[model samples]
Target: MPAEKKAYPLRISATVLEAMQRWSDDELRSVNAQIEYVLREALRKSGRLKAGMAKPMVDDKPDT
Candidate 1:
């Protein structure tokens, strides 16, 4: 099953919001998507996300 998402309120300065908006536009992603992507990357870099976590296989053939 796909993971569920939770919504939370955020408070930030207009300067930060504007910067994020510009970055999100450049990345071709919604502001929320960019935020999530950035947070996930930060977590991974900080070792908060396990490196050995499961990853899907690339093969497309049906199981025999």
Candidate 2:
């Protein structure tokens, strides 16, 4: 089964939001999905999220 999602309110600067909107548009993902993808990647890089804990949007190979 997939993990349940939780909703949380976010307050962001207009400039940052605009950038995110543009990036999300280019990536063909919703703003929410873009934010989640970034956060997930950061967590994984920092060793907070295990590779097996969450399914990646793409095949992520470790740095050589």
Candidate 3:
């Protein structure tokens, strides 16, 4: 079975969004992807992401 995705509404100021775009491009990722990646990493580092938590949109790629 495939997983489903849920969309959320996010609001950002223009200046903050511009900075996010610049950093996202520098990191070779879309703004959304960069944000998801960072959040996931922080959760993992903080031990908040356990082995059986609800799946999120981050790193849905297959192992290569």
Q: What is the C-alpha lDDT of each candidate?
A: 0.67, 0.79, 0.72
lDDT of 3 by residue, 1-64 (tens): 5456567888989998898889887877788877777777788879998745535555543454
Tell me, by lDDT, which candidate is best.
2
TM-scores of the models, in the given order? 0.75, 0.82, 0.64
Candidate 2 — what's its lDDT?
A: 0.79
Q: What are the RMSD figures for all models against the true structure?
A: 8.1, 6.1, 3.8
Please provide, for model 1 over 1-64, each residue's C-alpha lDDT reduced to its tens digit, 9 standing for 90 to 100.
Answer: 6455678999989998899889987877667776776777777789887765322222222355
Deviation (Å) of 29 in candidate 3: 0.8
- Each candidate: how many clashes? 0, 0, 0
Runs of candidate 1 with Cα error greater than 4 angstroms are 52-64
Assess candidate 1 and give its TM-score to the true structure. Answer: 0.75
Global local distance difference test of model 3:
0.72
Candidate 2 residue lDDT tens string, 1-64: 6576788999999999999999887777778888888889899899999998656554323344
Q: List candidate 2 stretches off by more than 4 Å.
A: 56-64
Model 1: per-residue Cα lDDT at residue 21: 89
1 against 3, candidate with superior lDDT: 3
